[model samples]
Target chain A: MAATRALIRRGARDLRLLAVPQCGIQADMLIGAGCVRGIEAAAVTMGELGGAPRFNAAVKAGAIEIRDSTCPAIHTALQASEKGVPFMPLRGILGTDILAHRPDWKVQDNPFAESGDPIVLLPAIRPDIALFHAPRADRAGNVWIGRRRELVTMAHAAARTLVTVEEIVEDDLLADEATAAGTLPGLYVSGVAEAPMGALPLALTEHYGADTDHLGEYARLARSAEGFAEYLQRHVLAQDVAA
Target chain B: MPVTRTELLIATIARLLEGCGHVAVGASSPIPGAGAFLARALGGDEMRVSVLGSRRHNFFTDGGRELFDCAAQGRMDAFFLGGGQIDGEGNINLVGVGDYPTLDVRWPGSFGSAYLYFLVPRVILFREEHSPRVLVPTVDFVSAPGVSEEGVWRRGGPHALLTGRCLFAFDRAARRFRLESAHPGESAESVAEATGFGYDAADPVPETAAPDRRMLDLIRGRVRDEIAETYPAFAAEVLGTAA
Candidate 1:
């Protein structure tokens, strides 16, 4: 969430974000920073940590616009953008209030089927930027996300993809066939920044576990706006990368 | 061994999943995850459980959309869902209470229920809280409807709902819930008093079975250990794995 920190440092605001299916502290931190004006995607929770305080508070206060959605819908929309399609048809969501709320999402008869085969169609989600943190990237900027192909799809669908890596490896990430399959080609990458421990307080699969002690503390502090602002001032803004 | 409430819930989940080939659990579902693990341990090679966030548990390589795709193709047999508000008709509200766009309270929003509820045959609704506020007469919003219209091409929907107080089995033909069993110490009158939604109850609601000694042992040992990998805090709290 270095990009989130950078935005906070630069005092960015009124941005829209997708939880990319599910979001936690990263999204909460941004929401608490008052950077997000709207959000589109599935649930916002701290997972095992606890409630996403800022998100809950924002929604309660009517501070931000919530585009209520399910997980597959978010992915289906991204897939439409990846394929350069206007929209993608998906099963389920019939008679749901979620469909009632989503104005852009449509329900139509499937042309492939006979009569009465209705489906939910989601408009493509081509984001202006897709930012995420990874374990490492090569000099070519090829980032190995292992089997987390959601990042690959995000890069493919977005206008620009920015990556923050723990380190820049000397070896070519895509040169090896095993790593090649999991590597996001630098061609899709707009920029790469090396920020060690960038995923601090958040787990970086195979690299490090989340600092749950720190996260637990954040969970406690983020319960109130003042406490959250204090967290922002102390941990996010004032603290350096190492701290 | 004395069975804790957590152990009882885990065993109940495992028993409910008896015939399933594969069960995929979503975020913040430790009890379900542990129960799935116990099922796999008992049911052997054919039974698969993918605890979504865990690399140690989940076997999918295609990323976030894989679970949805797997369900669409009839590969996934079951899933568990919970809600901020669940009504008598089986509709769940994951969005929030009060008016849309200006809610008095907001949840994290629907995760995969919009799609998964249709694709996975054994869609079990599990909520530990069995309060009138949560078990409502009618949900303020439908994150996913309990039952779709006859014409809608839905493969599956609410099979049953498990709560802290009791279990309610959904009859698709009737489009209503029938009280199955009440948890130990909870009677039909108690469940009714706590529940806002009216449901057909048997003359004498049977007590939900306690966890078998073997099952309790497995939960305290193998299941707890497995769950600790992903939900450490939960394991520590429920399973007492802190040591």
Candidate 2:
């Protein structure tokens, strides 16, 4: 998350962010600080901290383009890219308004089915870059993501993948059979940065819980444009100087 | 028995979820999530409830893709969705109000709402704020249409809409919503006044059932604790549980 923030701070403009719901503080921060120009995800919220104030404010102000996506659509799109497919046929979404809004999405008659039912076809999503925070990484760039396999999919689907981790272990993650299943091979990792507490305010699963009080404060402070600027200046910008 | 509006809404939703083998509640939906948990507790081991972001409640190992895959395969029986604006015809607008591309009010884009609404057999549209402003005549943008075109291969759509003022059952045949019952201290007339769209109302509408002592006990006890794992502040504020 911090690694992505650094990219945004370096004026990576008009970048599209893809993330799972409840894990999009970096995206929110990018949008709030005027870095992101578009986003594609299922949902983006503070998760018990309250609503996503910055994201919501940005949307209300019409400052960014958003592709309202669901978990499956994103996964399917990435899967299509991973498999080198132009599009993937999905079972549901024929009746959804989601299909209506997405001009790129198409409905086609089931080519193999006898019922002649329609199916939703989602285009492949090959992002320019995928950035995330992991629990640990090795010197060889193998990131140990544990059960967060979505990171692997993001790496496979995106042109490049960057990650921040708590620590850099000397041991080969793949040498341990138990850990190999959870490791994203260094082949897919573009860069690795060491940033302990990178996913603060958001949890790193077994490592530490989210800073709910701080997130609550963020939610409250980001409710208005002025407050949001103050929040960005205090938390993100100030933290940049300290880092 | 005295029942708060939140309890009544939960109880009403629980009743709507009767006999479902599995129910999936999305993020930021504490009421439905709690209700599903209550139903699971009442129904015993056979019942499965997956609340997104909850380690104890969710069984998905592959991240966000699992839920959509489960729903598509007919493994999920019920789900809940909310929108910024829901029309009489069951069309939900999660994308902002007014024109698209450049809008007067831009909401967080429509997530996988339309997709799930098409596959999940029992999609309950839920919103706490039931006013004319929200329950509009026609949604400015349809994030998910209430009914699909004939032969669109849709197996699931909206079953009912639960709100603070009343309960509305969706008629797939008519593609319109009908007032089922009103909450205590609210009448059909009040619901009509609050709703922007026309609906078929039952003559002499009954008051929505209150949560009984047993149900209330489960809600405030086990259900509250389980939901708190995913929605800490909501569980604390709504159910008086420790975060």
**Fnat of each candidate:** 0.90, 0.63
Give residue A242's lDDT in candidate 1 (0 to 100): 37
Here, model 1's chain A TM-score works out at 0.96
List, residue by residue over A145-197, the lDDT tens digit for candidate 1. Answer: 99888998999999999999999999999889998988999999999999888
Which pairs, if any, clash in model 2? A70-B112, A97-B144
User: For each predicted model, how many residue pairs clash, with residues at least 3 apart or on different chains?
Assistant: 0, 2
Error of 1 at B155 (Å): 0.8
Question: TM per model?
Answer: 0.96, 0.91
DockQ each candidate and list the results: 0.80, 0.48
Query: lDDT tens string, model 1, B1-243?
Result: 467778888889899899789999987799899889888877874788898778787899998899999999999999999999999999989888898866788777788998888999999999999899999999998989988887899898898898887889999888889998998889988998999987888877899988877787788888889999888888998898643
lDDT for position B101 in model 1: 65
lDDT of 1 at A48: 67
Per-residue lDDT tens digits of candidate 2, residues B156-226?
Answer: 99999998899999999988888889988999888988999998988999988888888998888888898
Error (Å) of candidate 2 at residue B169 is: 1.7
